[model samples]
Target: MGRHSLPDAYAAQDSGDAPPRRRRTVAIATMLVLAVAAGTAAAAQSGLLTFSEPCDDSAVRLTMAASPDIAPAARAVADQARENEVKSDGHCLYVEVVARDSYKVADSLARGDKDPDYEVWLPDSDLWLDRAKGNGDGVPVAPGDSVASSPVALATVPSASRTLGWPGKTYSWAELVATVMRSDEVRLGAADPSRSATGLLALASIGASSDRQGGDSDTRVAEAAKVLAQRMSDGDAHVLETLALDSSGAEAGNPRRNHAVLLSEQAAFAHNADSAGSGKLDLFYPKDGTPLLNYPYALINEPELTTTESRAALRFMTLLRNEDSRRVLAQRGFRTADGTAGTSVIASAGGRKPQPYDASAAAPPSPAALQETLGMWTITVQSARLTTVVDASGSMATLVPGRGQSRMDVTKASLIQALTQFTPNDEIGLWEFATTLDGAKDYRELMPTRRLGDPAKNGGSHREELAAAFAALQPVPNGATGLYDTTLAAYEESLATYVKGKFNALVILTDGSNQDPRSISRSGLIARLEELADPERPVPIIAIAVGPDADREEVAAMAEVTGGGGYQVSDPAEIQAVILQAIMTAGQGGQAAAE
Candidate 1:
């Protein structure tokens, strides 16, 4: 943690910059009461800093949800506060920021179930303040410096995208949005509104755009939700929480696989900078509007509060605003309050620059316009049909050196780990392929997309049962390859049986090329696949190749043809990574433009 100087809300309040006098009077009363008691007043006036509440010596706990855009800033602030506290002979403030998705956090606040002792609350949008208003005992959140005056905007990867840019200067919002809607390749990413500020902003932007065209924001939000629902079905997008950027990227919360994501500008900037050498991501700013993620420092005010913690919070605030801390924030791709850096950092950090952040601008969609837009909003998410096609062929028996394990063993282990990623709402089934299916048959009879909790369900179980199944997996003896037949069987079974489900996807993990003599030729297979997909209702097929023997070209073709993707992984360690990516990307609403 690096210590830096930040503006104090107390000071701002004292300087008459706070809300109305009535609110200021309440704040003053609260401060006086907090400073009154014997030991408390002595500690406050004496400048002795210590926590009023019990905190582990190793950690300064905080409750913050969905502030990826400000993590670096928050970190620097915490570090600098600890250092400043030490100089004043105070205990170290071990900052523990609880990262949740914007939607969950907002809901927690709405339900009044979130922790209330936090010294700071960094929200992705002020919408949360409205949600949290009547639920907490804290001072009213009637708009502050932390809330953005204008809504944030949507963004895209600049290199591959042809839309975006200002109207007249480039293309109008109508033209840009129309372009995106028509192209399957022009995939878009936004945070889940329920979990991320960026997601909320994206929703607001959609509403605003629709309203501009004579629709309602709420309806637009719902309509955009439908687009998301479809994308999720198609394996093109993932709805992960805000802070999963580094740990999981776009695959954080997705039950299926996805490659693109929606994050706060700050998070995106930080991620791009962290991946500067990789050059794999780009940012696109929707000209309409985006969620304004505003970070505000808060403190618990119950009678249990202590003077030490309050001072510590103030000290932390100072560190977050210090010049060095500001620099750290700039390095992570955000503009600081002190005007310390340029907005170009988004691109410099490896992502494309988005629309400028105008601190004083109005919220997206004027209040009067929001209603019309709400009517046009769209949101739809349905139960999906998912299948896991595993290769149990003898070739999987080969051992990889560095992993110190056979490829088959590793693949099974990875599959087991990936299973934990699924939620109860997801429909799952499994199939093992080799020269023959179980019971000496060419294709085994495994359950298809059954509910996870039923007794008859082999697909759903506690970790113990899942682990047992994984441990028992092994290639069958004296079997010839029937890869093609098995794939066809799985796909046909899902399409025929799970027709009622809104989305269907087949995940195939293979270590070699198609070897079944009965399997159709590559071109022939492509045509048949097209005919089966029924352009009106496409089913995505994600293929993961395991080793050098895997057919990269065939795998890519399968994904491209089926509106999904084929990812190659020579090492077992890459299985989890590749599978997660494919599920998120392919499961989302729109597919990549035919490439």
Candidate 2:
């Protein structure tokens, strides 16, 4: 027989071999030893044999940093695991869950300058994982299974719900948002997209849904974003605080209180559970479909983790996925990873049949699309203060390979188009550079940075004056690129006139390398920028190499010194998108640094 099989002659030996009491005791002892031996053998076979007693020694401790909204549920599961003495490879698991903002954690991870305090990270959305692993230079984080999910939706007080005809009447995300914006009585609020995954996802969904409706969708989305920005909160939890205190929505008249807010389904459920009667919020699941906030389980700096710690982290993730743990999550207003919830969970979150709550989730936006949306939102909300410097070297007159327009013409048109994206509150200036264009100087200021809404000396808005200047820009007859000196001049001026509480930057567009032998050297320019760059008043230089002739590596190295980045475009038309993308990247980096 196998080693696990008992001997057949043991029963025969026990048949009156000793006194009854002694036989009983001996038999009991023998059975106990055999059982333990069998257990030990089984454990050894599974590669989990441990010499220490369970929970007495060899405990595997781990720290988990979870998004604030889902931290409580994760902590509950962790608590239960400790109480039950859950084991990983025969070692007790002791997990500590800490609530941290997903954005902050992502920023820290993206920097990757130091070791993280937590071994595990549970962000509210997988979107944050992409942010944390920015450009593949950040700390190595391996994403595991999603633990829970929540759909993004609009939440409203009773009066506002009645106004929007929630539950009984449904609208697409675009329609719902448009209706909310058009209404004078209803005020909308949201978490800042730059800092909230829920906000960014909802915004992206609105943009996508609006595209389906056609007819100037970009303008419509921008207008909606502006409205939401008026009452924007710092983050998800803070956005809830912006809601009207009165369930009747009478406080809608108060500028500080909002009648509606973009929120997660789980957040609505938690709010409703704590509220009574009409005080509870009613949710609207946009007809186009809602984006889900998938709470992804991630292992931070996995390579740096010990073998036991790594196994324990995964084991805890398994525990979180177990049925009991899922039930605990549901009780706290979270849905399953697949976005399904029980009837009670749905009802608590203000969902009902025919509201499209059961509809399939909207496809996740591409990383590029999400980045663009965030870039747009960042510039819009912060009100940029930019000094745009254009290279007027003769090379800018080169004709495009396909389009009939010259490179200079295309660059101008693209810049003008980009200008439309900025709000009236944004400050903009213009400058042009070439060899000896301004007597002793290689660069000349065309316009001083001022609010687009501010009046110009020409008796029109600064916006119009700037537009005219952009249009009139012409390549000097035989000018050489004075990139290094022009860049240093622009950076110094931008730093000197730094506007507090704005997205300040110096935007430089060039078509070639620095050709003015009299100008500063690239190394000198970089050293000067590094010395002048102030964290207290950040003004990154967004340098774009506009054509094949421009040295991308040269520009990139210089730009990096000022906490900004560099980009190259084969076609001048691509400059518009690149500018916004650069701003988004720089803004996020600056924000992270400040934090």
Candidate 3:
């Protein structure tokens, strides 16, 4: 474990910028605490950091949840503020900062099971602060008062750098990722985006890049990007970790090596700091754009906060913005709150020498767009092991007033385009339904669930088979919609064949209501759906209804219970956008857009 593993709360409580001698002592003391945590003798009362109730007689207490990586710098600043004995309106103050995983804290805040006990939450990125608010129903998340910032970049070993180009060559984020994805020489690794901004930003860049392209190129790049993102979903800081790791444990000349880790610039600084003398990992500043990990000092403003505590919190925030505080943070590899590469980062005792820098950091996408991107990433990049059920009824052949193609033709093109938004490894099958289209069966499997390639299964890959089947699909002229029964049957089959480690969902593209007399009633369908519903084992139904004649209400109801979504499109051409939104919205536990 790096020096950051020890809880900053204890070591930094009163150590106000320790001198060289005291710093070593503090380091040893922290090591002892860590050792005790791992020690067999301390098994009964493990070395977990816990808070003792602060006595209320003399002061106001400011508790903070600091991101684990930067917790040390935060602690140092807090310790100095502590020494100052910051007073607000004659009240003395106490500041306490504990290392907490940003995702876990955000998750807890979203669950509403616990109120954030801290007067402030210092996540490494604003993304967590945004996520913690949970669609704005709960407490409004106060914006981050950024105390520090870092840009998401790639960190690679020297050997990989030789192949991918070094500090002199500038590659756009798209060009850079495509190079890594197309080859097996060096595997690109990313932090699980749910836990850290590093991986999230990488995947978002890929999605945005693909979104900019036209036609089949968009689909091809997106599918490939998703595969890369999934392959690189290592836990937080895996990128930095990979820089030092080797299976052979060989240092520089070994064949065994990790290629690249999409990470924050600060992380690269930290890793290079850790390995000062040898094997320095290099940073890659993307040419196109990058998302910054702005370490916002977001105040926890609750109605329950005491007036004195609020004042004290403001005072604490002011202290953090001071030169001394900024200096402490900058020395530890973070950019100053304003985001400049001050000499402090290079001049600090263990800091790595500064590398070539680029200033074209991209502005964050709109809040809705960011959420959609995140939702898209969570669903499509992680991917669904889905079985698509398309309506093959006579109504699907109805031609529109303006659009040139039949509903089925537009629907086929849309489905094909949507497939580009998924990983090639994601298992998918095609099924078409209408009453008695295949003798007594309302639905018939056109392609069995398999991986993308035909050879992935005994006969053919799901991707090739489904694409061919969809292209050849013709609406049965005499067929009646089999909405309810087909959904129930499909849901059951999907549930039974659910693959582990895959986001499971059923994509239903329909044009009309259940007109089959033999089909189950809406009430019966809902009851069966209720029986199958499980948040623990979710298989959402992403239903898209085209044209005004489609039964959207009933289709939406089925989606609602199964933790999916129902969408209505005036044009079959709009099916692409609706399906995209449906899948993205459904991926995030179906947090639908506000109606």
Q: What is the lDDT of candidate 2?
A: 0.83
- lDDT for each residue of candidate 1 in 101-124, tens digit (9 for 90 to 100): 444444555565544545455554
lDDT order, best first, reads: 2, 3, 1
Please give, for residues 408-511, the per-residue lDDT of candidate 3 as tens digits.
Answer: 98888888876766556777889999998888889998887777744744475667667778888889988999889999999999888877667778889888
Over the stretch 1-595, how does candidate 2's per-residue lDDT look in tens digits? 1111222222222232222110101101112123346646556323345555557567889999999989999999999988977666567789999999999999888998588899999999888988998778888887776778899999998888889887889999999999998898788999999899999999999989999999757657766776788789999979988888664456656878988999999999999999998789889999899998988888888777776677677677767766788889999999888777788988899887678998888988988889878866765567789999999999999998999998999999999988886778999999999997999789999999999999988698999999999999999989999999999989999988987878899899999999989888888888999999898988888899998999989889998988888889999998877886677667656531232
Prediction 2 TM-score vs. true: 0.65
- TM-scores for all predictions: 0.47, 0.65, 0.63
Report how far residue 531 has shifted in candidate 3, in Å. 17
Question: By lDDT, who's the top model here?
Answer: 2
99: Cα error in model 1, Å: 3.2
Tell me the RMSD of model 1 versus the true structure: 18.9
Q: Which candidate is the best by TM-score?
A: 2
**Cα-lDDT of candidate 1:** 0.51
What is the TM-score of candidate 1?
Answer: 0.47
lDDT of 1 at 121: 59
